[model samples]
Target chain A: MTELLARLPETTAAHLGLSLAALTLGVAVAVPLGVMAARQPRLAGPLVGVASVLQTIPGLALLAFMVPVLAALGLTSIGVLPALLGLFLYSLLPVLRNTITGLAGVDPAVREAALGVGMTPRESLVQAELPLALPVILAGIRISATWTVGTATLATPVGAPSLGSYIFGGLQTRNYAAVLVGCAASAVLALMIDGLLRALALGLERRRRRVTTASLAGLLGLGAIGASPAVCTLGTRDEAPIVIGAKTFSESQILAQVLAGRITEQTGDAVRTVDSLGSTVVFDALEHGQIDAYVDYSGTLWTTVLGRGEPRPGRTELLDEVGRALAEERGVHVVAALGFENTWVLAMPRAQAERLSVRRLGDLAPHAPRLRMGGDYEIFQRAEWAALVTAYDLRFAEQRTLDPSLMYEAVRSGQVDLVAGLSTDGRLAALDLVVLEDDRAVMPPYDAVILASERLRRERPDVIAAMRRLAGTIDDATMRELNRRVTEAGESPAAAAAWFLGRPLPP
Target chain B: MIRLIDVTRRFGDRLAVDRVSLDVAEGESLVLIGGSGSGKTTTCKMINRLVEPSAGRVLVDGQDVAHQSGPRLRRRIGYVFQRLGLFPHMTVAENIGVTPRLLGWDADRVRVRVRELLELVELDADAVAERRPDSLSGGQAQRVAVARALAAAPPVLLMDEPFGALDPLTRERLQGSFERIRRELRLTVVFVTHDMIEAMRLGDRIAVMSDGRLVQVGTARQLYEAPVDATVRELFAAPRRQARLIESRLERGAP
Candidate 1:
């Protein structure tokens, strides 16, 4: 709990920075566009239509889409940039629509009176039309602000640190307290921002200068404080920080911390981790030099990166081919294999497996017609699952996609008869589940290998050397124990990683 | 001070005002009396270039109105709308000072002018200057609107039924106040209204319009005694008939 609280300041600052920057930019772009549209009826339809279309896209998909869209434009594709762009786009519809509506709703007589009183078109707008429309425009901004704060929680998956990091990391590790804290904090932040803006609108409507000044100050002051961390870092840092990437699971998070610890110890370089990234996003980020290093499995590279579907190679051959293909074609360096294979394994409750006599993949074929199966979100979509189905001719009565953390509990509690789980997942032993043997050797090797970007290898070879020291350091038993400490004993990934390195916890 | 020579206006295919010509001398009050769509309002608007002429020319102070920008030309001409279009967002003082401020008068000058105009319109400067238009009664709001028009002290004033929205008592009171201000300032006035009695009461000369054309322009007595057409005669008949009805009622009550 104390550790989670310690992370609160940094995460809250990141969340505020992303939301406020996006909202400020959103207002800068949207207000003028809205005014132009309000004047030119021909433009009003298309401008508002485009913003409305953007609003229809689901928020998470919008953030994820920025990754590739920005990459194609040769811009920053990960971290805060993509997240900020996505949030800015989301904030446009409300502000733009309200600006147009508010101006259109102004009394025509009042408008004519402005001209009658010798006001120029420009003066009429700035002095009369805008002042009258202010309350409505402020209402739109309030809606946009609250929505931006709430949606910023989704930025974690795109490699931006936010309050969402707590939710994503906590859910994967079964730390409910962290999730509760993230949810409650974000709700409070949204409410406070909303309340302050409402006060500003009321002040403007009632023409209270003191109330307006105070509320406006409160709003900008909060934004500045939230954005200060990012500003300070940009001002002070002389060299770019080395960014480590991690997938959205406890094991990957631990491995990333392990890499971060080793690099910092040996090279004394500034290290930052962008965690909770999707599998494909992490690989694409590394390929584009958005991240310096991450841990990936050999089987993922062979199937997903190499696009190989047939003729599974020997374990050693598979690792060598993956390394060669990555280095030659993608300019990625294979730093080291961590000497543990966390491959896909079919698991069932021990008592259930014993009762059903399902000792091997081949043995499951007869019972598959009656049993229900479950797997993590990605397993049912992978090539290895297809290979197993064809090799064993297995057809389950029902198959469910579950979170990686929850699948063990699902099978143990009899919600599923079988689950395709990682071999090194500590829950396999902790819950007394038996692994069904791949008697035909249909599955490919999944040796954990460290991969570094081409830029990192060239520019920071010492950092790469520091990472190479981790070669064959963590065997299957040791890796399983590290996972056990997080999944069962409720330890954080950083604590488990520190234990492995034989060092005290950081801070 | 104001001249419209063969001035015409068209809203797309519809001719709102056609080839109407008139002139107002300096310090003269000319009232335009006509029913709805009779082009009286459109003719008045052309003097300030609020509605551009589709044909012919409009001249103010012997200079063609089109020669200057609309805002610059409008700054030199005072106008009051039929609806008394006071800016709801501005205080009474701000609304009155709008024209002077737009004419680039300094802050102290605008402030002094606002107070003087408020006094000229018989409004309490301290009580009403800081209040918004929404807070004022019908008579007070109408006074503020007139004060706003007279702020920059333009030579020409165009009023389009300025008291049409007020109750009869309020309208009468405002009309009296306006006549006093107009004479005191010697403003060249072109007032538009549908009320024949009001035209007779306030206008030095009344111009009657029908179907976007000026049918007659003369003093009230000249038009009443020698009307050119049935439209001008019918405009005069309403007031004459009302006078007879009231006279008969007074005679029967004499006992």
Candidate 2:
């Protein structure tokens, strides 16, 4: 929890920076467009329609969509740019709608008085209409601010460091304290912003100069404090730190910290970890040089990256094939296999397995007709699931998809008879679940391998050499123990990684 | 100082004002009296170009209004709306100083001018100058509107029922003060109102309008002696009947 609190300053700053920048951009674009729409009856409908439509696209998908959009434009797809752009787009609707509505709601008599009093149309808008409409516009800005702050948490998956890091990482590791910190901090930030803006609106409406100035000062001061960390980091460092990527799970997070520790120790280079990335996003980020390196499974590379199906090769041959294909096709270099396979395994509660006499995958076929199964959301959609079904001809009475974290509890509580679980998940032992053997040897190898971007290998061969020392060091038992320390014991991934490296955890 | 030559205004297919020709000499007051939709307001607005003439031309100080931008022309002509139209967001002083400020007057000059105008309208400058329009009573707001119109000291003033929303007593008090201000300033005025009594009291020459055309233009006695039509006679009939009722009540010693 202390470690999580220590991370708050940086993550909160990044979250604030992204949200404020987006809102500022939103105001810049939306206000003028709203004014134009309010004046032009023909334009009002289409202008608001476009913004309303943009808002309807789910926020996370909108953020993810910017990755490809920016990449196509030859701009950086990951990190702050794409996340900021996505948030800016999301903020447009509220501000634009309010601007039009506020202006439209102005008394026609007041508007006429503006013009009648010798103000040009521009002067009327600037001096009279806008000022009168300010309270409503400020209300819209407040809404946009809170919404932007909350949605910014989703920016973590796109490699933008935000308070979302705590929530996503904490959820994967069952560290609710970190998640609570993230949620509470962002909620407080949103409320603080909303309150300041509300005060500003009231001051403007009531024409109280002192209240207006104070609230304005508070808002600007908050923005500057939030933006200071980003501003200070600019142009200060001689070299960019090596970025280590991690997917949204305990094993990936642990392996990432391990790799980060090893590379920093051996190369004496600064390193930063971008954690809680989606599985495919991490790989794509590595390929595009958005990250330096991450740990990936050989089977994931073989099936998802190589786009192969049906044929299952030998374990060693599959590793070589995946490594060669990635290097040739996508410029992602497979450095070394980290001697543990976090493969997909069918597991059942020990007592249930014993009662059903389901000791192997083949043994499950007879009892499968009466049994219900559960797995993580992606398991049923994965290529391995197809291979298993084809090999065993296994059909369950009912199938349910669960989050990987919740799957163990679901099976333990008898919500489902069986679950396709990860081989190295600590909960397997904690919950006393038995793994059903793949007697036919149909499941492909999922050896954990270190993957590096072409840019990293070309620029720093020493980092690669350091990472190679990790190969064959961690076996199945050691990897499972690391996972258990994180998921069950509530230890952080960094601390578990530190334990594995035989170093005292950082204070 | 203000002239409307065959000024015609149409909103889409509906003719709001048709061939309305009128002129106010320097330092003269002309009231345009009509029922609602009778184009008295439209004729008044055409002088300031708030509503442009669909045909013909409006002139102020011998220059065609169409030659100048609407705002530039308006800056030289004072206008007060029927709704009083005080800016709710601005203080009374700010509302009054709008025209002078827009005309590029310095802060000190505009501030001095705002106080003088507020005093000219019989309002306490110190007490009301910093207060917002919403804080004012109906009579005070009406006075502020009048003060705002006279702030820039334009040669021509167009008032569209400036005290229309005020109660009877407040309207009468504002009308009396406005009459004194008009004569004191010797301002050329074009006033629109539906009340025949207000027209008789305020207008040097009353122009009665009906159905988008001028029915008669004359002094109250001249119109009373020679009615152009039933509409013109009916406008005078309401005031005459009210006077008769009040005179008979006083004769009977009623309160």
Candidate 3:
């Protein structure tokens, strides 16, 4: 809580900048396009139709899709640029639709009057038509202002810092306070901005110089602040903070925080985190130099990246081979192999496991046909699942794919008798689940290792050295405890990491 | 002086003004009178190039209206519409000053002319100059529209049912004020209306139109006394007959 309060100013700037810049750009582009569309009715439908389609896309998908689209266009693929582009696209519909509708709604009689009074088409539009349409257009701007504030939070997953950072991090770690703070702050910011827009409309309508000037000044001030490069660049600093990335999961978030905390403590260099990335996006980001480092499991690198179909070797042999392959193939460096594995494990409620006397996969085979199984959505789709089913010759009565965050609760409530779970999930301990042995070793070793891009290894040896110190420090128990502090006790990952390192929290 | 030399206007396939030709002597008030869609408004618009003729030409002061750009020609000719189009966003002063400002008159001159026009239209310059259209009554807005049209002191004026939306009392008062302004300024005017009484009261010569064609052009007394056809006589009497019919029907229903 204290950490969040202390960092409030930076968070507020990021949240405001991304959202406000998007809206400013949206209005700038859309208003002129809307005027053209209004003048040329033939083009209005296609222009508005495209914006409508953009608005219909899911917010997170729209933001994430910008990564590759921008890369192809030779633009920045991550952080504030892509986030702003996504937001600007989303903000178009309301303003564009309203401008068209407002222009159309002006009295035809009044238009004839303007023409009769010798107003050029241009003069009529500027002096009479737009002013009459002001109220409606202003309403549209108000809708967009509030909407962008809330949607800006989703930018975090795309490596942009926003208030959504707090909410997404808190949701993963199950911290309700941080989530509440994020939601409240954004809502309040939206209301304040919306009120200012309303004042602008009133000023225009009533011709009140003071109200109009103040309102315009306020909006321009926000736009100016948002336009400045310092506010618009997410997770960037003058000293160029070492950016750490994490995937969209609780353990990944905690590990990223641990790395950032450790790096900042040891070197006194600034560290910025761009967490909540997509599963494979972190690797892609690192390859493209969008991020400096992140942790990855060897099994993920082996199957997803390398496309190897052979049975896995021992953990030590697998790590060396994977490390060598990554270096040769993608120019990524295996900075250190954190000495803990997070392989897949089949788990069930302890009472249920005891009742069925299922201590191993072979033991569970007889009871499989009578049991309903549950697992994270990806686990059901992975090669490990197919291998285990084939080796054990097991079949469940039903199998459900659920979010990993809810898998423990689903098993605890007997919604499913079994779940494929991660070996190091804090929920496994907190929820008192028993792990069944994988005697056939169908699942591959997944040693959590810190990986860096080749650029980071060659150019910033000091950072790699600091990162290398964490290689063997976090064993299974220590990793489990660190995860527990976040997932069970609702402690922030930075605090847990700080405590583990016996150092003060990084500013 | 304005001359419509066989001017014809078409909106798609329908001819709004078909082969209509007329002349307004300098300082003459020529009222084009007809029922709705009779092309009176279209003919009035043609004088100022608001509606360009599909065939033939309209000449203003010996120059073809088409020779000048639409905006340039319109700036020299005053026009008033039925809806007033008073520019609700601007103050009465701003609305009156629009044409003069467009003409590039000095700001000081424009301010003085705006005040003069406001008073010329019988509105108090101090009380009404800063007020917007919405704050004014319909009659006041109509007057401001006239003042705006007259701002550049254009020699020729085109008005299409300028007082059509006002109440009868306000309409009559505005018509009297317009009559005085016309005589005082010695302006050449072409007024369009469906109202027979307004044409008789204000026009120096009335041109009666029917079915996009002018049926007669003469003084109001001459047209009222002589019958061009059943349509022209019916046009003049249609109002009184309709009113009597409605009154009789209402009295019968009351019993």
Q: Is candidate 1 or candidate 2 better by lDDT?
A: 1
CAPRI class assigned to model 1: medium
Preferred candidate (TM-score higher): 2 or 3? 2
Please give the distance, in angstroms, between residue A481's alpha carbon in candidate 3 and its true position after superposition: 2.0
The regions of model 1 sitting more than 4 angstroms off are: A235-240, A350-377, A380-402, A406-418, A437-443, A503-507, B246-255
| C-alpha DockQ for predicted model 2 | 0.77
TM-score per model over all chains: 0.94, 0.94, 0.90
Which pairs of residues collide in candidate 2? none
Off by over 4 Å in 3: A220-238, A261-269, A306-321, A356-420, A438-442, A465-473, A502-507, B221-228, B233-255
Candidate 3 lDDT, B1-255, residue by residue in tens: 898899899999999989988989999999998889999988888887778889989999999988888888888889888778777778889888888887889999999998888889999998899887899988888888999999999998888899888889999999999999999999999999888889888899999998899999999778879978997788668878988999999989965
Better of 2 and 3 by DockQ: 2
Q: Name the 10 consecutive residues with the lowest summed lDDT in model 3 chain B.
A: B231-240
Estimate candidate 3's RMSD in Å: 4.1
Candidate 2 residue-pair clash tally: 0
Cα lDDT tens digits for candidate 2, A197-242: 9999888787689999999999898889778878766754445469
